[model samples]
Target: MIFTRKRQPLNKLTIAHAAYTLQKEVKWLGITLNPTLSPNLHLRMVKTKTNNTIKQLTQIIQPTFGLCQREARILIVGVMMTKILHGSIIWYTNKNRNTVRKKLTGRLFQAVQLSTGMMKQPPLPCLELYGGIRDITKQNIRLAHNYLHTKLAALIDDGHRTLIWKDLTVPQPIHPSPLNNLIEKNTLLQQHFTRTETLSPFPVPPWCHRGSWKENKSGLALRNLELTWRAPKG
Candidate 1:
């Protein structure tokens, strides 16, 4: 952990969720109404839904932290939060270091709740899976027989999605955010995450990391998603 995001500690006075917004971006190509098609944004609405799971993250983030209307947002079109999940390798910071450590602690390990599933999307002709995301668009593989789909399959089979630990009684692989911890991930909690914005190296199941080209078929990507804690249905 080399980077540490800077922030002033929580004094109860600075714990303001109203000052923030959960804006994360999704990069994709879009197909419009008729002949015209281009890249578009699939924004997720954070507005409290009837489903208990959807509100889980927003409830904590909305009142406890001081985030803005993003509670109604699912995705922010062009923004992303990869650094918070996958972590940084080259230039690190305090914001990132603390975030990294808080995320792996054993105590909160049991508290994390995740859902694994998938949504319908299209296919990409070829995906340029960037490695060691920093500043370089480095190339990894040039598939001959199969392209992105095959690569996504390998990621899923290898366990990119299938790790859920709602009970925390068992050891589970960590990924998805909006995770609850006895201890806070950000020591100096702020309205928004100030640490390095890093992406997981295939952290979310291939499906979670899916795009126009390939998708994770196991429905394990649910681990990266969050839903409100509802009492089990009768």
Candidate 2:
């Protein structure tokens, strides 16, 4: 696909003695790339897939049948959400595009409603609140922020980091990338380094022993003490 905002004629080209034509859109690495680089097509495809999945899930999930509320919530989070937000880091932005956001959220809210066994009359905020789901826009921003942080952490050279930082944080009057929008929305991201750094090292250590700790008195006592210390205080 030829990515550009200007009007241009599609010209055929020959590669390795084979003639090729320009495509209106091309799917690469699961993301749809169009001539204008707009995410509308990709979002539409995702919406269709999500709707189909929801339809199939409705068969097994009911008000009081196949799946309980807790199981429904798990499925929504683990399956539906993962599918909906699949390449969101590349396409999502919390800008002034309410039309796109509304369409996406409306479809997503259906899954939440199904999980919660509620009708469609509830507002988005109410649906998200009772459904125990995060807003799509917020989640996209979070994923972008995490992506940025991870990228920054991986860069060892200060010069490379500075270049990347300036490129992403620099103000663009005309058009801004998703990362730029994220930085604009959260001023804290403008900092050279994130205040809250998260690390996911290789072979993550287990939080506790493998076996049943309740069998050992000392382990049980330690667990209770830890739980008490971590518990919310009144």
Candidate 3:
């Protein structure tokens, strides 16, 4: 697909004796892209797919039988939300816009309502709180920031890092690019840090032998206890 801001006629081309035509939109890597790069169509498609999945889930997540509330919540959040927010880092922006926010939150809340067996009378925030789900906008922003953090941390060349930092930090009027918005939203970007440089508790060399499970039972028990304590209480 040709990406351009102006409306124009499609151009026909022949390459390797094969005819090709310009497409208004195309799917690449499971993301739908148009010439204008607007995310509306892609998001619509995601919403449709999520709706279908929710319908299927409703069959098994009955109020009287099938998956329990906890399992339903897990499925909705872990599977349904993960699918809905797939590729969000690329197309998600203007998250606070009323139209976009309402549409996405409405669809997500439907899934939450299904999982929690809640009535529509409840407010979105209450549904989210009871369902143990984060706001879709917040989740998208966090994902974008985490992606930026990972990319920045993985850069090996100082010059390349500087170039990227400059690009991300560039000022844009009115509507800012997603990366720039992420940089602005996250204070973590103010400092540069590398994952490789971070200190680890287990600093022993790879060649060093570790103790057997029998010898590490106390540590294992402590770790398990910590995890159990940290887990959400139903």
For each predicted model, how many residue pairs clash, with residues at least 3 apart or on different chains? 43, 0, 0
TM-score of each candidate structure, all chains considered together: 0.16, 0.24, 0.24
Better of 1 and 2 by lDDT: 2
- State the weakest 10-residue window (summed lDDT) of model 2: 220-229
lDDT of candidate 3 at residue 45, scale 0 to 100 = 61
The local lDDT score (0 to 100) that residue 159 gets in candidate 1 is 23
- Cα lDDT for residue 107, model 1? 13
Q: CA shift at 8, candidate 1, in angstroms? A: 34
Cα-lDDT of candidate 2: 0.34
**Candidate 1, superposed: residue stretches over 4 Å from native:** 1-56, 60-90, 94-96, 103-112, 116-234
Error of 2 at 142 (Å): 36
Cα lDDT for residue 196, candidate 3 = 11
Error of 1 at 9 (Å): 40
